[model samples]
Target chain A: MTVVDIPPPLPVRDRTALHERAPGALSPMLTRLAEERATGVLVREHGTLHLAEGRVVHAESPLAPGLDVLLTARGTLDAAAWPWTDDIPAATHRLLVAGLLPRGALELCRLGALYDAGYFALAPSSTPGRFRYGTTAAAGPPGAVRPLRAVPVTALERETLRRRELLHRIWPDPSADGAPLIRADPVAPPPVTPRQRAVLDRVDGVRTAPQIARELGRPAFHTLVDVRRLAAAGLLVPRNTVPPPPPLPPVTDPDIALLKRLRDALEAL
Target chain B: MPGIDECLLEAMRLPGARGAALVDWTSGLALGTVGEAPGGDHETTAAEAAELARLAAEHGAFSTADDTEVTPPVEDLIVSNRDSYHLLRFVVTSFDATVFLHLWLAREDGNLALARIRLGEMAERLVLG
Candidate 1:
């Protein structure tokens, strides 16, 4: 008799019970999947994450436009010639055969899109949706699908934190993150860097950071940082209707002495 | 012919290579990294290097005579300390010249001239689609 080997069957769960889990439960579910070394697609309400051996190899979300759109935006791929499909390997091979880009460039763009969309996918939304773990060959939703080098879950989480911190450092106000970019007067035009100028040119007072990023064929995170910096520089129109208060004047020596005396007097009282 | 990872690995193969990273200067993000970081943290190192690159790329004083416009004026920057040398080689892409390769080398064994030539060639050949 000849011996043969067969892979084990995948675990399956109905969709009805998936939503029964508590809202904002993706972190824990992802942790569980990572622990099991699960290989499949994790489809959430906002987007989908493709995993291989418990590592995220690709991700897609409406918030972050797909690689095809980005390439088209850059004029590398003619919009009419671009291929639209959910099959990542096929699309990748098609792009490669057309001599549109090098293998490394494709890999970089895939990783960039994965991280960009991953940030939004893992974000805390108003309502958390269900997740389905399909077989290893399962395809993601109909959107931009590109293959990426598998990234560990821990690294993705760390990168997300880093991006959040980078945004906060540039401008603390999170309200402007998704808001439209409007031109405004800054007393005098603030000195702008070349990159910021490029971003400013794209600002039409209608598109949000992510949208502008898609149009410019740049990473969404990079666009967010530029918008925040422009806001901080007083270049973009303020998100709030009311203007910010004028900066306080520098305190003189007399003011410091006065403050010290007031503190001493309060202590004595 | 080389991918980002392979390029970084090639950089590390250089004499006295300590660490290497492919960074997007605009966003201060590391696309990929290899070996140990000089500042003990790759993120911090990348951010700091990006700041330097931005400053050099923006300043008019660094602009070349042939190029009156301030379009990514500087091609590369080299900073040397007592123990190590930091090289920031700008890579021009079809879309934007916002990416660069950062390599940290120990002074004792590193050849600054050879490293500079190799990085320049790598930058010219880099393809980010």
Candidate 2:
């Protein structure tokens, strides 16, 4: 006789208590999920991370290009892989069955894009993250494309930290990240490389680093590096917003309850 | 035809292979790794190796004449210090060619010539899916 063991369900009450403690709790939230060996989608302000049994299966962010964009941009994907990509599993299945991509192309490309988005998804922000428990990320088999590789949360966090340090080492100031850059020092040329030139040419005082990355079909972190380098070279204008997020005072809001009371009294009058 | 683990294991079959890892040079993420790591940690080694790989692949001086294709500019980089030989061979894929195979071997026991040739072959056939 064969006995199949079922995984335990996610504890609902414990997670409900976590919501009140959030608003800047992505790290702790991910740690809790890892401890639970839970399966679900972690939805955040900047992106979403799909977790499967304590591992990060997929991460998506607006700052990073999607797998479709990366594939279509390369022009190497078959026509079938393009439209059918609406559903990841089906698209991967077709790509594999059709022998369109090599054995690991889909997985590699997805992993590349996954790291890009994962970095942004794990960025320290003031917004809270919400984890909805489910099995969407756990449906894939060993070699399925939907869940290419199950990355340990510890590994993901470490990689993300390394990337952050790399970016910091490249250019300390992060104003170029979200701010439009201008050609600040045009008189003296800094002798930019061809790749840096490609990134610089996109700088029109309108597009930010992420926008430039999207335009060039490159990772946003790479663009951030280039932007920071350009800024360091005294070529691009830096935004005034350079300081990191500081502790904020209590939010001030109008007395809506008193206003409603006054209105009710006026109506009675 | 070999997956990440199988390919790394094949690299380990080399005479003096100490460790091997498949790293994405662009994002500095190790797709898979086997055997020992250079600094006793694969993540740090992968990051440092990626910095070197990116230094080669990103510059115009090292770029190949062929600009039409999406392949990386440099093929592989061989770095040898006091005792060991580090080989980083770029893996050209359908989407992007930012991935590379990193093999660590002792200079005395390792065969650089044979390892480079075998690593090149492994990079060509490595399947990550």
Candidate 3:
């Protein structure tokens, strides 16, 4: 096997104060790592961001699915044939060779995943997490992977702030961000935009905004914006009326048809 | 299959181009940016432009009668001020019509018709993975 030179891990910082100083201290930690040109993974409570030469190459969060899931969720890649492995680079190469995804498209999806996951990873509520700078090659979860290009940390921060503001502009309620979507009464349903209608159809009153986004294979932020807009328009069930359900099980065979329908509805919208 | 950076760079090469960005209208995120922003801040400009894009894409009056299925019923929107022109060209992807290429152009040096044509071409070739 060919050996690769891995950079030394940066010393661990307590960062408790940073977390207290701001809701999302991960930005500062990321900024520091970028400034130092550190190359490693910054693990946090929500997810992990892989940094290479001071730039963020990839990010993964439980709140947002990874690129693989996004691709497969959209039926771009066959779920059964997905190559699951710890070796990301090799897997990426294999996918390229197999024509599963074009190089440019893969990169775009990677970037999209980075920002999508970054929104939740750097959320103010994802606090009290530790930061360890070490190569993720040996540390990331079994399926966690890195991207081909490393995006500047500043760009990611700016995009995150923009998304937050966009959602706020649509509706001021943060509760709508995580609440399960339920269609309002048909008798007096507020007029909804096409996209909002598409989202409303998937509102089983059980799946939260994030879960709906995963099912639709769209970015979580996009789903949040739609949900917030729908709530603002009074087209969705009031947040207080619906109690959040227990965590959902992974999408299984029975759900594929539902996901396909969601996908078709989204495309039609 | 040009990346956002390359697409923005190509957009900037247009006549009188002041700034360009690939914005996700749904989330108001700038996938990439190039040149100078109208207000000297790309982030704010992107968000503001997204508001316009959202309005055009969502309002029924702006859509054609025959376009019952397209997410963004309108093809493009142009907002011109005293000195600059803001062009929002919608790009359809595998998913919803949530992304657009925003171009801020100087009125004196910009050619609106040509810019629109070029933006359309770029949008056709532009690929977001």
Q: Which is superior by lDDT, 1 or 2?
A: 2
Worst 10 residues of 1 chain B by lDDT: B64-73
Specify the highest-TM-score model's number.
2
Is 2 or 3 the stronger prediction by TM-score?
Answer: 2
lDDT of 1 by residue, B2-34 (tens): 678888898999999999999877667788899
Clashes of 1: 0
User: Which ranking of candidates, highest DockQ first?
Assistant: 3, 1, 2
A132-236 in candidate 3: lDDT tens per residue? 676644223234233355678877877777677767777887887777667776567667777777688899878888888887887787778778877877777
lDDT of 3 by residue, B25-52 (tens): 7777777789998889887888788888
Order of all candidates by lDDT, from best down to worst? Answer: 2, 1, 3
Which scores higher on DockQ, 1 or 3? 3
Error of 2 at B43 (Å): 1.3
**lDDT measured at residue B39 in model 1 versus the true structure, 0 to 100:** 78
Chain A TM-score from candidate 2:
0.72
Runs off by more than 4 Å, candidate 3: A1-28, A75-104, A125-127, A136-148, A238-269, B68-70
Structural similarity to truth (TM-score) of each candidate: 0.77, 0.78, 0.76
Higher-TM-score candidate of 1 and 3: 1
The interface root-mean-square deviation of each model, in the order shown, is: 3.1, 3.5, 3.2
Clashing pairs in 1: none
> Which residue runs does candidate 1 get wrong by more than 4 Å?
A1-26, A88-90, A96-100, A136-148, A238-269, B59-71
